[model samples]
Target: MAQTTDLDLVHVIKRFGSHTAVNDVSFSVAPGEFFSILGPSGCGKTTLMRMIAGFEDPTSGDIRIRGKSMIGVPANKRPVNMVFQSLALFPMMSVGENVAYGLTSRGVSRAEAEERAGRMLERVGLKGFGNRRVTALSGGQRQRVAIARCLVLEPTLVLLDEPLGALDLKLREHMKIELKQLQATFNTTFAYITHDQSEALVMSDRIAVMNQGRFEQVGSPRELYHHPATPFVASFVGETNKWQGEAAGAAPDGTVAIRLPSGTMVKGQGRVADRATLAFVRPEAIALAQDSSSLGGLPNRFEGRVSAVLFDGANSSLLIDAAGFDEPVRAVLPQAGPLAGIQVGAPIHVGWTVEAMKVFAA
Candidate 1:
């Protein structure tokens, strides 16, 4: 990997009158690493990206590339390029012209610009589409063209703002693999923004989960998956079951016990406090059984009637209605091997391993 240098942000804040779009948020990116800032529509991920690209100036704080500060640098003067969500490709221009736009703006000659443009197109899997009109290209081709234009500049860093949000599911999946490979081949730092958690998990070396202009957690995919730092992350990362309870005793082995209103004590692993409010358990961790729930060995267990069953190829998603644990406790059963005679309307017990239970305060 060709590392450029570290990119740093210090107390970066963006405000619009009294509303702060981006609070005092800060994070860093390692050169040549794929880092993603993920959150919902108004979470300020895109706002931070624009500020870094110089399209918008931070109201306060500072941003640095390598070791040089970039407080007031103009967009074009920065050693960075961005592929906008709308792509911003010129409609009147041809495919080759669109790719060579950056080069021409930088004073490259027409002949050299055209040649380099063709090569860049080829690099992004659009080899011979150069002579065609930009309008003639497909959505995926347009995306590649946008990427090629940015890459042609060979900047120290690249900002991709939801580049794959426009493509279909199958194309989006394929492009995810291609985009990761493309970044490695270019060996440039990539600071991408997306609202899709699955996309962030699949593409990034590290993910920063943001909420309301603040980062809720930052870690690698597996770390965020198995050990979410917040309730928002645990519920948002993937499908999870949540319960409201209060701490009842001391957990010697790091397993906190939360007592429900019905006197049911659900013991599991989490940071427990005297007034703990929430418990999180991933659906995949919960299992359905006909025998005893083994609640003593499990952190949480509930007896319920099967409400629904959905067979999704490799796994079957089960929904059970249980007392004290409302909202339909769910579980995943193996597809190749069903859980033997389990059906809707059958009485069953739902259980989860102690380690599978995640407790969070509030």
Candidate 2:
């Protein structure tokens, strides 16, 4: 049996006068899946979400929810709820009243609405704080209340538009875990939109990397991180050291050789029709050897001096100025290795295998 889709966008496009915000976008979300549209501001993810919520009509294509087309449906009639970055919680109402407002407005009895709201509050880890004022709650608590309010109505799909953007960094990190747990516990389909790569990589079951009104790539977190399909994805999705070069030729093993402007030759596994190309290697992919002799015939080798030591506890990195390279290359240092004590101006040998480098047309 085929699994039912929770939300589907078929060739969806949104335009404002002459500028296109969303360009022929198409994708589907599975039931109970946490799908995220990740991109920088002005990428049209918000416009697409509005189309899904019926706040804005698509210039073309269909928006479907649970196999039903929602072409002309009003926002209030749709079986979806959106949680905004500001949360949009009512300040005048108590937490309980705020949560039960939707149900009571739909003619649900006050007693029953309050009862369901209480249960929902408990489900979201706030059991006895229903009568408290919204202002009395912490940022994360208020965020949970906002989510609880939406979940109380048991909507078919929940749209979160950067709901954690207002929280402090520590709280945002904490809520990422909490939000994922809440979605799993309720088994609700969550269509989250955010520009934060760490948030998407940490919580999303699948992520669509949007750019310039289109999806650059769509895949799991691991897949996008390890095997980016586009140069934008490679640069945007994570930290990498990029080298601009020209394609020399393909080796016998099918790896494309690239000749950098510095006249250094490097090999990577990819097809590039354009002679002008770019190569990216993750900071962690390059390992530092204490001496050149320790490289032991690595496919790629470069001698460099440490220009800076970026110490961030376990995530420390070293900035190296390699000979013949115009820009400094960054390489992450192991938590407790010989390279951990590497200082500025220290000579280090950097080495990485050919397969670790990703080549793309410039």
Candidate 3:
């Protein structure tokens, strides 16, 4: 069975004079799915969102919602709602009034609007607080109110533009879970855009990694993390140690050997076409060995002196100055192991398998 597409963009291109913001991008969102566009600033993610919301017209291509064209539709006429980073909840109105604003504007009876607002508040876990002033609510409560305000209108798609960007670190972490729960509870299609990889990975069913003015890759969090399609996607989606090198040639086992500028030979699994290649090994993929023998039969091995210990609780890592490499190699240390107490200037062995190294043509 083919699942209904809630939103579809066909070769969408948005250009400003000579500069193109979004260049021939196309994708679709399944009904009730939580999709996210993740990228750095000025990556055209927000511009794409604005186009979908009808605020800006695309220079080319088409946008459809529920199989209906949205090319000529106005912002207010679209069956979509946008929740901004600021939330934009009305401080002057009571929580109930704020949530009912859209319904009341559409000629719904005041009593009916209030009744629906109350139910919506309950659904968002703010039960019995409709009559309270918006100023009295906490940050997370205010976010829920903003969402309720949009949901009250029964929009087919909800666009959240970095809705958690304004919250503190702890609150943002807490709200990520709450936001996913709310989205699941409603079973509504959510198109989220954010620069935070953690937020996108934690909440999205699938993520579109955007760079410059286009999507570099789109996949589930695990797929993007484990098998990034491009060098940008590999470097942007997570923490990794990247080294630039030239392709030395392919080995019998199909692993391509790369000769780094530092004259270090490292082998990785990938198609090596371009002579200029970039290799990425995730911090967690490199294992620290007490001795050369501890590396077993790993293909790539190096000895280095510990330069620094980055302590982040269970996420502690080590910065090692490996011989023949100008840059330090970062490797994750086990939370509790014999190497946990490794100190600066201590000599250590680090090694990784060819499969753990992702090689891409630069």
Candidate 4:
């Protein structure tokens, strides 16, 4: 027998006046899967999430949780719990009280609620912290409390709306792993929404890249990064050097040749278009060498001068003023290699294989 789906949206659409907030969005989450909807602000991710939570009505289509339709369900009556960016924990309540709030309000006895809440807190690494006021906890601790509160209700689905957005950079990074771990520990279905690509890439089992009120693509992070279905997915999900060019034609081996405005010809993989096309190369895929001979005879090679070096510890990159390109090319700089000592204004040769480049119709 087929397993029941955890959460499903079928042809979901929402509009305020003529502006479509969510347009024919449809997908499903499997049981215990960590699924994320990722996009920039105002792309309608929040509106889609609101419709799923029953705070807003869809203009058309259906939403289901565990095979039951939620078309006319109210938020409080639905089997869904949400953790918002604000967390919404009561300022006056202790950690345990906050976790137990839903249970007590739903007629669970105070003793049973406290016991359940305490168990949930301990499961979330907040053992023995039940009596502390929420304000006294650190940002990360408070986040755990918020998650514990939602999970204690044993809802069929938990929806998180950029829950880590309020934390500092370091804490946000930490929480991504922590949240993923908690989901695995509980085997709970999580529907996470975020604008941060890193958060979605690091934590989600599967991700749907949303853009302009629709999902551009849906797949695993590696599939979205290494094999993007749309030009928007290629550009938005990661950093890459892009060029507007004209398609010269296709090779026998299925590679497309693109002629840039500067007269430099490059080859890549993609559907061949008749005229306008876009090419993209990841920074890490470009190899830097002191001279052309060291490039091992790559299909595409360019000589350029280092314009600037952006140092972000292990994620450092060098900006190169390559000949025949309007914008500077970015190449990753290894931390302990001979190229690391190369200074600004130094001449360098950059090379990448034809397969490393991705081309798409404009």
Tens-digit lDDT string for candidate 3 (112-136): 9999999999999999999899999
TM-score of each: 0.93, 0.98, 0.98, 0.98
Candidate 3, superposed: residue stretches over 4 Å from native: 1-3
Backbone clash numbers for all candidates listed: 0, 0, 0, 0
lDDT score of residue 171 within candidate 3: 96
Query: Per-model C-alpha lDDT, please?
Result: 0.85, 0.94, 0.94, 0.94
Give the residue spans of candidate 1 off by over 4 A.
Answer: 1-4, 293-299, 340-342
lDDT of 4 by residue, 200-284 (tens): 9999999999999999999999999888888899999988999999999887776998899989988898886458998999999
lDDT, candidate 1, residue 95?
92
Q: What is the lDDT of residue 296 in candidate 1?
A: 49
Enumerate residue pairs that collide in model 3: none
Clashing pairs in 1: none
